[model samples]
Structure formats: structure tokens, C-alpha cells
Target chain A: MVNYLAGLDAVFLALADPTRRGMIERLSRGPATVGELGRPFAMTKPAITKHVRTLEQVGLVRRERIGRIHRCTLAPEAMRDAEEWIERHRRFWKSSLDRLTRHVESGDKLTLALTEERDE
Target chain B: MVNYLAGLDAVFLALADPTRRGMIERLSRGPATVGELGRPFAMTKPAITKHVRTLEQVGLVRRERIGRIHRCTLAPEAMRDAEEWIERHRRFWKSSLDRLTRHVESGDKLTLALTEERDE
Candidate 1:
């Protein structure tokens, strides 16, 4: 599980680049051959291929070798683990805030009393 | 707006570090003074301070100067924009999948008909 998170870290890090994000966006529409995907880029084929490899390592994109061409498609579940991680912490924050709200409303009388007793 | 996204890129990139993530997780519980926060780490105060500054730059943490000490607190909304960016594309993917599902279920009759007409 921790190893999976580390993989997601690489995915997120790879996606931190505009070019990579653009590539993913394009892939989302449908699978495309490597050269077709590279048409819009000013970068060299090797550079684009490297980017694609990084995406594949993270499972954000999967490449299929059909005949002489490599076709790439989006992998929707690539970021699912990262989303789950954020969601897990989101629940924690939500619960903490809920508790804080209740405590604020009730003035946390027990804690206040303990502090007062300590002061004396 | 793009500049804001770039800021979030730096924020996410900064957070890609494990040490930085640990610092954030600790800060989330509550605010802590610099020395207090650095106690668990083998790293120096300057190193910790640099990490905190990176977090501060991304608005993930805020530092308060109280006399000679600095207190750092988590900034919850710092990642909100990044979340929103992900959400915006999430909807697109959802819609695209929905359309694909519908097309599959309907056997894409219209597309087939159009292709047949083109062939004729």
C-alpha cells in the first residue's frame, strides 16, 4: 500500500509538468498513436517518448503495440489512490472541525475547569 | 488564473518530498513553534525553516512571529484550487465515460448509419 502511494507520488510529480498534463488530457479523449500524439508538441520524439514512459510507469497511461505503432490510452484509476489519500485526510479534517465546532459552542467546560484548577 | 495554477504546481511539487509531507502532517494537528516542530527531525533548524518557508510560499502553512519564535499553522484552503482543478476534469471524464457507455448500449446506431451512408 505504501509502495502504491509512492508510485502515485511519481505520477503526481510527472503530472506536475504542463506537457505531461497536456498529454494526459489529450489521451483522455481517446487512444492515439505515438506520432499522432506528438504532432502538437515542439519537443523531439525521444523527449515525448520519455514523457509517455513516465506516464506509463505511474499507470496514468498504457501503451499498446499494434503493428508498427504504439497507441496510448488514459488510465482512469492511476490517480485513484492519491484521491483516496486526500479523501481519507479530508474526513479527518471534517471530523476535527466538527468536534471543534461543538467544543466551541459548549465552551469545552471540562477543559476550562481543568485549566482553572491548574491555575489555582 | 494560470499563475495561480503555477503556484499550485510549486506547492504540489514541494509537497512531493517525504520530509515536507511529514512536516505538513504534523502541522495539521495544530500550530507549533519552529524548535518544537523540528525536535523530531534529525535535520537542522535552517533545513526545517526552509521546508516551512516552501510550505508557507504555497500557502499550505502560515508562520506567526511572536517575539523571536515562529509558530506555524496549517492552511486548509491552500490545496482547494488544486482540488478544484482535478474536479473540473473529473466531470469531463465522467461525461465522456457516460457517453461511451450510452454509445455501447445503443450500439452506436447513428454512427453506423452515417458510416454506411458515407460508404454508399
Candidate 2:
């Protein structure tokens, strides 16, 4: 669990950049060469490489080499982890809200029951 | 569209920290005073304030001043936006993978057709 939380830190950090996010969006469609991934952005080659490295380090993007060519693709595991964290919290928040509603409704019912008893 | 993407950058950046995430997780359960939010971590007040500021700036958290105390709660909008972006891209990626599978399956069908024709 500790390692998973640590990975969440790196995953969100990697995704915090627009350019890197764009590259991931591109790779989501299909595998691409490093050059292909960088072509859509106006960033310099070094900047692109740095962004790619960050994504690779977070395990969100997989980069492999075949002789002279480099391929990059979406790895999905880190992305899934990040999604799960947000989703789990969302569920927690929703359930707590449900509990609060039930508590309030029960309070109202109790108040009504006491009023009826007093009238009788 | 651009403004929304810019918001995503800040949202993810704010979420990149473990302390901020812990605060968010706590806030999701219910509202808490600024001091209450800060009590979980063994950090200085300034550090906690900085993290809270980051979350507020990204709009993931809303902080309000009530009398002498400041209260914080999960805003949910930015978190929803983040979830939407991930879900949309996940759908895109899944569709693309399905297309690739169909393409390969069609290729296999063509090869089988040719093999049957030769046998006849």
C-alpha cells in the first residue's frame, strides 16, 4: 500500500504537464515511435525526451528500443491506479453523504413519532 | 477547452503530493477546519498551508473563513473533471485496441479464405 501511494505521487506528477499528457493521449491510440510522439508538440527534442522519460519512470508509458528505433506506448497500470484512488474516494464521500441523509431522516421520524404520542 | 486543460494541469499538480492527497481524502468524508486538516501530518503550519493553498487554487478544495476559524471541504468539481478526462481517454484507448483486434482477425479470415480456395 505504501508503494502504491508512492506510485500515485509519481503518476500524478508525471501527468501534471500538458505536453506529457498530450503524448499519453497520442500513444493511447496506438504505439508510436519516439519521434512520432514528439511531432505533435512544439517542444524541443530534449524537452520531449524529458517528458517521455518522466512518463516512462512513472510506469504510465512503456518505451522500448529495436535496433535504431524507439517505440512508446501506454502502459495503463499507473493510470488505472490513479483512477482507482479517485474513484474510491468518490465512493467514500458518496456513502458518507448517504449516511448523513439517513440520520437526518431518522431524526425527523423520531420527532414525528414523539409528537403523535404526546397528542394521544 | 484550453482553460479546462489548464485547470487539469493545476489539479494534477496539486494532487501530486501525498500530504495534499491525505488532506483531500479526509475532507471527502466531511468538512473540517483548516487546523483539523493540518493535524494529520507532522509538518509545519506553513507547509500545511501551502499544500492547502495548492488544492484551493486547483479548485479541488474549497476553503472558507467562518468567524475566527477556516473550514475546508472537498469541492469535487476538479476531481470530477479529472475523472472525466481519464475515463474519456480510457474509452478511446479501449476502442483503439478493439479496432486493432478486429483488423488482425480480418487478416486471419482472408488468409483462411485463400487457403480454402487453394485446397479446392
Interface RMSD of each: 6.7, 10.0
Candidate 2: regions farther than 4 A off: A1-4, A96-120, B1-4, B98-120
Chain B superposition TM-score per model: 0.70, 0.77
Clashing pairs in 1: none
- Individual DockQ of the candidates? 0.19, 0.27
Cα RMSD to native, each candidate? 6.9, 9.9
Report the poorest 10 consecutive residues by lDDT, candidate 2 chain A: A111-120
TM-score of chain B of 1: 0.70
Off by over 4 Å in 1: A1-4, A90-120, B1-4, B94-120
Clashing pairs in 2: none
Q: Model 2 lDDT vs. the true structure? A: 0.72
Q: What is the lDDT of residue B113 in candidate 1?
A: 22
Model 2 docking category = acceptable
On residues A56-110, what C-alpha lDDT tens digit does candidate 1 reach at each position? Answer: 8888787867567785767767666655544554445555456444644786452
Fnat per model, in the order given? 0.09, 0.51
Write the residue-wise lDDT of candidate 1 on B1-120 in tens digits. Answer: 123357657755765666666666665554566666666678988998888888888887777675676756667577666555555555566655564456447864524322321211
What TM-score does candidate 2 get on C-alpha atoms?
Answer: 0.78
